[model samples]
Target: MNQLDIDKMVLRLNVGYNGFKFKESDLKDGELKDWAKKNNLLKSDDKQKD
Candidate 1:
């Protein structure tokens, strides 16, 4: 079996966070909505910054 790095995957999903830094916790979400909230993606109307 192969296990993907969910953290890297989640970080890459964020258009603002693409190629940007992210906290390991971002990958801990069981749902995208929850993850988005934790990473401030829901409230972030603009591109994110490092």
Candidate 2:
């Protein structure tokens, strides 16, 4: 497996996170909805549509 390191500060301004941590398996398993929910990017009504 390969890993990438990102600066949390840079990401915060762009993706709205002061700090973030993730494993490659998250992507591999297609878990972005979980991520969005954690970041408050997904609304409950939006989830119901899916």
| TM-score versus the correct structure, for each prediction | 0.29, 0.30
Candidate 1: the clashing residue pairs are none
lDDT accuracy of residue 22 in candidate 1: 39
- List clashing residue pairs in candidate 2: none
Q: What's the CA error at residue 18 for candidate 2, in Å?
A: 20
lDDT of 2 by residue, 15-50 (tens): 455334333233332344455546543335332442
Q: What C-alpha lDDT do the candidate models reach, one value each?
A: 0.49, 0.39
TM-score of 1: 0.29
Q: What is the lDDT of residue 47 in candidate 1?
A: 62
Find the candidate with the highest TM-score and give its number: 2
Best candidate according to lDDT: 1
